[model samples]
Target: MDVVEFLSQRIAEDEAAARNLLNDRSVSESGKWYERRVLLECEAKKRLIGIVESARQAALAAMVRHPEGDTPWIPEAIEWTTLSLNALALPYVDHPDFERRWLGT
Candidate 1:
């Protein structure tokens, strides 16, 4: 497809991922800590969704105005999307025993 179409698709994917994170219901509210953690995650996802959507809109607008030239907002969109994806990755990856050691207290 064209550049605009490609970017739009990527934006949609980002939006979808954010929605999924915010709407997550897999973890039941077993305890105070667990409930608090889930709420924090949802809030984070909401903020990420706003950032991604704003960047996507700017990129789309730029593409519309300058269809022949480079879309300047594309970089910002990519950056936000990358940050969002990075946040989804497991933290403390090298230390597989992190949670066990840290949370088992």
Candidate 2:
């Protein structure tokens, strides 16, 4: 698939994972502190999605502006998509604040 299509699919997958993580009752019921932290993480994921969407728009605009020319915008789009995926995965992986707040460390 093309870069744009690949990035779009990645973004969709990340969004779904974020939604599932946020809605997980086991995580939510960990503790009061954990619940609050997960809520914050959910908010962070939402913000990341906004940022990714903005980047996607910019990339599309760039592509349109240079339709028959060099495709330099693909790199930017991929970078943004990667960053967004990383942001979405942060809560599940490692982060001091996430550990302290979500895991009650």
Model 1 stretches with alpha carbons more than 4 Å out: 1-30, 70-105
lDDT of 2 by residue, 2-55 (tens): 333443444455556656765776655555455556456556656666677777
Q: 22-86, model 1: which lDDT tens digit per residue?
A: 46766344544454555566566556656666776777777788888676667677666545544
Question: Distance (Å) between predicted and true CA of 93, model 1?
Answer: 19
Candidate 1 residue pairs in backbone clash: none
User: Which RMSD values do the candidates have, in order?
Assistant: 11.7, 10.1
